[model samples]
Target chain A: MDICKRRLMKELSTAEKGLPSGLTLVSANDLTSWYIDITVDSNSLYQGQIYRLMFMYSPNYPMKVPNVQFVPDENRPIPIHPHIYANGHICLDILGDGWTPVQNTVSVCLSIQSMLAGNHTNERPPDNDSYVRSAPKYAQDSRFIYHDDSV
Target chain B: MPETETYHSETIYPVIASDIAMQGTKTIDSLNRLVDYSSLDYIDVPGHLLCPICQYPFVNPYTTKCGHTFCKECLIQALEPNVDLSVECRCPIDRRPLNRDYVEDIFPAPKIISNMVNDLVAYCPNKSRGCQFQDQRWLLQRHIKDVCDYALISCGGIKEDGSVCSQPTHRKFIMEERRIQRDYLLYGYSMLPPTNARLMYGSSNIHTKNNIKDSASSSESVETKDKSNSLKFDQPSKNNLHLNAIKDTKLYQKLASQDDMPLLELQEDIQIPCVHQESDCANGCGIKITKATKEAHNNIGCTKVMLSCEYCELQVAKPKLNLHFEQCPEMTISCSAKAYGCTWIGIRRDLEAEHQSKCHFIAMVPFLSKQDKKIELLEKENKSLRYHLDNISQSLANLPSFGNINRNDSVSSDSTTYSIETTESLGALPVLPVDLSMTNASISHMLMENDRLRADLDHLTTSLAELEMKQNTLFMQENFRNQEVMHSIKGMINTLRQQIHYILLEHRAFTTNSSNPVHIINQSSKVASTNPELLRRRLSDITRQDVKL
Candidate 1:
């Protein structure tokens, strides 16, 4: 196994024993891709909803950041906010330009859950319709101007 | 998983023989990668054993200023800045910031921790090839060099510019070879020692065996006597006796008689045969050919030799040659229609004419395009030449007028004019006289040039003003477009805010009393559905009244 796979195996074993409340690993069979579910344990928007996150890793994981995005399905609708588009593409700065290698799949999931929990208004992004028309499949590939920190 | 504490002593040095047997002769690239410490039988490895970045046991462990330990390589990788200059590195366990200064404050892990890591025993990576060796991590290199059978040693006699030849041989063979070389150098004799003499020098046991055999027998034989003398020759204390015996020999006298002979001439007389004839001759002809003759034989007479075809790799014999060029399959000849620009390659007999006839680009289009490109380049050159000619003629016309005007000045003695013969209608123009009158003409010419310059400046300023005005209007139009976009954005934001406010108010009212709120919302929705347009108008009126208030 490569370094990334070994690290994921250690993480998997640890997470199996116990993880923080409201954070769980949905599936992580291969080193290149993993899925996680996160829910904010507070009285705020997206309080009860379990948001599924997809993390795609390159062979250079732990040295290079992985691509984290909200995976929408029939059961899990995209959390509506100013930074999240209707098509489930997020515009968070840390998921793109502000990413650091020390961050892992769990950290990214927690950051996104907090971002959704802090929202006061539940609505698609301001230019959701127009942006969704031409959004890249991976949120990391999209060039987003992240000037707001309040989500 | 069994608890490691159960087998604390055994775990330190686990039964690695079977594990080494399974790996079988594979070279270890990294010792840490070879051994999975997490699964070892030793005392339970703590969480700190694994690097936070790679999740492997910490290699070259370093402690940061934040009291967190990590592999040195992993720490460097974490602190690497992304595209932006600001580094976003921090301790993974605690979110304390780490920078270059913080890293410089790093120190090696405590000695006890490092000793525990180093004490983990591992089998030799080459145990499968019959290496029965195991050692602690730090002593592995010494074991491999001193006792391992598979370690390679360089062939060490011939030196080319002080660099020993590095062709590796087995350790046992290289040791034997080095012993032979040392014995040969010490003897100061010819390199090719007699077979019996070599056996005597190979080991001291053989000499003792010969002495014991002689003693067991009743006779003190001559060969036994010579063997005893050879033993004395090897000893340093009896060296003078051997030296005196060597001087008294007839072989020494013969060598002394040849002292007058030039060494160079003697070296030339003993010529070594070419090594190629013995090695390269496959037929075993046993012909002792000299170096000069071997060169000729290699060029012509060697029938086992083969010559490769220039077009392909087909080898043909020089002595029993065949018609290789005519019959070889891969021979590449030029296209028959190469003049037509069909740049195709294959066996010319196979493809040249066939491809040329079907190639459309080669037919007429390429020729036409080639001519068009030439015409374009020629037209560009013609335009440039015309421009240069116009400039030259204008300068020539101004030259003589300036010369005549300067001739009347105090510096006229230094001004010389070359007679330019312009055999054209321009020769009929009036010429200015070289006198006080020419100075007046010069002044007027300067005045007219000044007027032309002033007019050019005026034209440029007007153009600049017009450009500024156009730019100002463009900026104004851009501002208007931006304002329109902003207005639409503001309206969208206002609607979203109102929707959010309504949802919050509904959640509050619904949560307070679910019974009456649901029935009331249902009745309100039924009334709005009956007359949707009227309901929308009333809602707008309410928003307008709110805004007025």
Candidate 2:
């Protein structure tokens, strides 16, 4: 088996057994893709809203960061924050150049959960409309300038 | 079932013997095997044993200078992408700089840590394949290699089409086939007639004879034997004779086939050779041999084996022996002066003796050797002197005044020493150099003293700046307090002036009321009318007042 599949199997088993609060593994179905639902449990601007996170893993996963985005669907929508765009692409440093191999699906989910929970602004990025119209399909391809640390 | 029973009886002996033999000689190719540790069922592995980068148990652990441990492979992969970029690689856990100066800041993990990680208990990696073996993590590899029957291995046989067999087989089936093949090769037979085989066949024969006797003794016995035979064979027999004939044929076949079973079994053995006779010598000897002769071949017969050179005592492989001889320092060679009519020849070790005695170039040899030694010694002294000169120059740059004073003092002392040398005996001239060396030592000592004083001055200057900042804040606070005091005193003076003005206005009103003469006169007449003594006293007081005025 490829290392990506082997690592995914371990992570899948761990996720199936249990996940931390506010994170639900909706469907994995295969090794290459997975879906998780994240909810902000704290009393923040996104407290009552839930967001669906889609993780697409490449063959060089863990060495290469997985592509994670808030997949807007029925009953779950993209979170509104100063760093999160309308198209659900987040500008978190860990999701971009700041990613390290030590992070996994569970850690990513918890980070997104905390990112939503810590947000106070109920709006998208300042250039949300223009960026969302021209953004790439995968968030990993975008070169986001991580100028904000207050999110 | 009957066919299987007969086959098991024939193959059982050699199978047991080969199984026992294989236990001692089992070897697994563990070098290229990649173990997936995440799939293993660990018995509570400690967190410290896991690599923080991969979140798995450490494989080939290495420790960094920052006191963090990571898997060697994980660290390499983490550093690999940054190799092309100019950025320095850092420890994944703590982000401490790792590849500084292009040197990795990591070392092999401590022995205790390696041992502890190896000692952790884990189930076999092939547990999902129905293997139940469990042991310490280090032993798990050996189990998979030597014992785990469910481990997947190639068939390791070529097909009739002249291509290697690519079918995957379980280790259990492969090992059984190897055992059978080894037993056939060593014994030259499929079945071994051990004493135990005869005992097993003898017991069955006795049971058949008892059935024949019981059937002849009574009709009830005949019915019971027929029922038992029916259950055993799943077919009803009419009488004891029929069942007895079936038993006779089974025994006869077992004995007869022991000598000439079939060509099919022989062909299978030929297709797969003995495990001992598998591969060629790994040392590149190019001769294939059985495992029994492998040790001997590697020890002595393999020409590619490493051996120590007899002349130089340097280790060189057998194939490289001639190459080593060309550069061997101890190799014997004729003297270099042979062309000059010198016939001396010997090993290089004794070449010095030849040059010292019989060589025609002897005179030049000693002179050249002496000059070489002298030049080497002079170079070493020159290096030391240059290092001292640089140090003195650096100190002079730091304190120019000190250097100037020391130079003047040394010049004056040198002049005094010269004057004394001229007056005294010639022996005192030798002491002049010693006095200059003493002055040189003192100059270095004074330079060290100057450095210490400079450090002290820097420390005091920083403390003084801190005190000055504190005093400025204190003065500003006092000035603010004085301004508040002055504002309150000015308001107090303004309130006093207003109070004096109000008193002056009240005194003027009283004087104006006293200056109303007509009202005063009426009031005096009213007083005189009320009392005659008041009028007489008023007239005498008025006359006295008029005289005083």
Question: Which predicted model would earn the best DockQ?
Answer: 1
Candidate that would win on lDDT:
2
* Model 1 lDDT tens row, B1-549: 124323211112222321333334433222212343333332334666766786656656777787877766666666665577655666655656677355365667777766766676666645654566776654555455444554443333222122233444334433333333233223423243221223322232212222433322221122233454464455554444434544554433444566543221221121111121122243233444432244466566776568887766777865544577766656775454465565767874465447657766557766767887888866765554443344333433333333234323433222212112221222233333343234334433543454455556667888999999999999999999999778666666676687686667657667644767777577557756886786467457544454444
lDDT per model, in order?
0.54, 0.60
Query: Candidate 1 regions off by >4 Å?
Result: A16-19, A40-44, A143-151, B1-43, B65-67, B81-113, B116-549
Label model 2 with its docking quality class.
Answer: incorrect
The TM-score values for the models, in the order shown, are: 0.34, 0.42
lDDT of 2 by residue, A2-117 (tens): 34676788789889999999888999977888999888869557765678999999888777789999889854878888888888888888887677767889998888877777
Can you give the lDDT of residue A50 in candidate 1? 68
- After superposition, candidate 2 runs with Cα above 4 Å error: B1-39, B82-88, B100-104, B151-549
lDDT of 1 by residue, A20-82 (tens): 778887887665778788777573677556677788887777776677778886346777788
